[model samples]
Target: MPATPAPAEFPEDLTLGIRELDDQHKTLFAVLDRILAVSRDPYRQLDDDGTNTVLDIMTDLKDAAMQHFDQEETLMDQRDYPGLDDQQEAHERFLDDLVRIEADLMNGTAVPPVRLHADLADQLAAHVREMDRELAQFLNKSEK
Candidate 1:
C-alpha cells in the first residue's frame, strides 16, 4: 500500500513580515495537523481517551492562538496600526467560537462531529486569507 502523505504546511504567502507572528501562524497549522492526526485516525476509538485528547488539542490551540493575538496586539500598539481594532474584533470572534465549542465538549452537550474538523479548517483558512493577509499587507506597506 502507498504511504499516506503528510498534512500540508502553512503556505509561504501568509507571512505577516513580523517574525514572531509568522512563526505563530506556522505553529498553529502544525497544531491543527496534530489535532487532525489524533482524531481522524482510522483506528481511533471514540472513548474517553480519544475525547480527552481532542479536548487537549483544542485547549492548546486556543492558548497558543490567544498568545499570538496578544503579541500581535502589542506590535500593533507599538506601530499604531490602523487596523488594530478590527483585528481585535476578529480575534475575539475566533476565540469565542473556540470557547463555545470547548464548553459544549466539556458539558457533553454535543459530541464533536466529524464536520467540526472541516468547519475549523475552513474558518482558519478564511481568517488567514482575509484578515491576516490584509494585516500583512498593511504592515508591509508601512515598512516602505
Candidate 2:
C-alpha cells in the first residue's frame, strides 16, 4: 500500500467541550493520520513489522473510543440528557463494528491497509460531521 499524506490540518470545528473526549478524538485522528501516511508510502506496507504497528494503533484507537464514549455517556447520564440512550447505543454499535474489523485484520481476512485506512477516514469524517458535532452542540446548549 502506498503512503498517503496526513492532512495538513485537521478540521478544528470538531472540538467538543469535554476535555477527555476531545483529547481522545484528537488521538483517533492521529491514528488515522498514521494510517494515511502508510497508505501514501507503499514501502510502509503492512507486513510482519508494519502489521504490529498498525494493529497497535488500531487497538489504541479502539481503547480511546471506548473511553470517550464512556465519558460522554456518563455526562449524559448525570445530566439526564434526553438523547442519552440513543447516543449510548450508537457508541456501542461503533465499538462492536470496530472490534469485528480489528479481528478480521488480525485474522488476515480483511482488506489491505490502504483500503482499510481509506474506509476509516471516510467513516470518521462523516461521524464527526454528523454525530459528534450534534452531540457537542447538544451538550453546549444543555450547559447554558
Candidate 3:
C-alpha cells in the first residue's frame, strides 16, 4: 500500500461567509480528514476495524449532511432564492453518492480509503464553491 499524504486543511475559498453553513462545511471536511487518519496509509486495504471506523464516520457524515441540507433548503425557501431547486437537486445527488459509497464499503467492493476521501472532498468543495456560494450571495443580498 502506497502512503498517500493526508489531505490538506480545508481550503479557505470554500467558506461562504455564512457562519452556520461555513461551520457545517468545516465539520464535513474534518470528518473527511478522520477517514484519512483511520490508517497510516490510506491506499492500503482497510482491516476489519478500519473498515468499521470508516463505515461509522460515513454514517455520521450522512446524518450531518442531511441536517445541513435541510437547514440550507429551508433558508433558500424562506428567502425565495431562485436556485433553490438546483440546490435541492445537488443535495440529493450528494446524499445518493454517500449511500452508494456506504453500500460499496459494506459489500467489500470499496476503493481505497484515500480515493474515497479525495472523491468526496472534491465533490463537496466544488458544490460549496458553486451552488452554496451562490445561495450565500443571494441570502446576503436579501439580508441587506
Candidate 4:
C-alpha cells in the first residue's frame, strides 16, 4: 500500500478578523500540519498509537469547527444578514464532510492524506474568499 501523503499548509493570506472563527481555522490548520508532518517523516514510522493520535486531533478539529459554525450562524441570525441561508448551508456541508471523513477513518477506509489535505485546503480557501470575506465586509460596514 502507498504511504499516506502530507497535509497542506495554510497560507497567511487566509485570515479573517472574526476571533472565534479565526482561532478555529488556525487550530484546524495546525492539526492538518501535524498530520502532514507525521505522514511525511521517513524516519518516524507512525504506529497504531500515532495513528490514534492523529484521529483524536481530527476529532477535536471537527468538534471545534462545528462550534465555530454555530457561533457564526448565530451572529448572522442576530444581524439579520442577507446571505444567511447560503452561508449556513455551506457551514452544514463542511460539517457533514468532516463527519464523513471521521467515519471513513474509523472504518479503515480513510482517504489518502494528500487528497484529504487538498480537498480541505480548497474548501477552506474558497470559503474564506467567498463567504468569510463577505461576512467580514458586512461586519466592517456595520461598524462604520
Error of 1 at 71 (Å): 0.5
For model 4, which pairs clash?
Answer: none
Clashes of 3: 0
lDDT of 2 by residue, 61-109 (tens): 7887888788878887887777787777777877887788878867767
The model with the greatest lDDT is: 3
- Taken over the whole model, the C-alpha lDDT of each candidate is 0.73, 0.70, 0.90, 0.73
Lowest summed lDDT across 10 adjacent residues in model 3 is found at 1-10
Q: How big is the positional error of residue 70 in model 2, measured in Å on the Cα after superposition?
A: 0.8
The C-alpha TM-scores of every prediction are 0.81, 0.79, 0.94, 0.78
Ranking by TM-score: 3, 1, 2, 4
Candidate 3 stretches with Cα past 4 Å from truth are 1-4
Clashing residue pair totals per candidate (backbone < 3 A): 0, 9, 0, 0
Backbone-clash count (model 1): 0
- Against the true structure, whose TM-score is highest? 3
For residues 2-116, write the lDDT of model 1, one tens digit per residue.
Answer: 2323665677667667687778888877776665565444233345666677788889889989998998888888878888999899899989988887777677663443445
What does the lDDT read for residue 102 in candidate 3? Answer: 88
Give the range of the ten consecutive residues with the poorest summed lDDT in model 2: 36-45
Error of 4 at 5 (Å): 8.0
Query: Candidate 3's error at 39, in angstroms?
Result: 1.4
lDDT of 3 by residue, 1-144 (tens): 566675659898998999999999998888787888888788887888888999999999998899989998998998999999999999999999999998988888888888889899999999999989998898899999
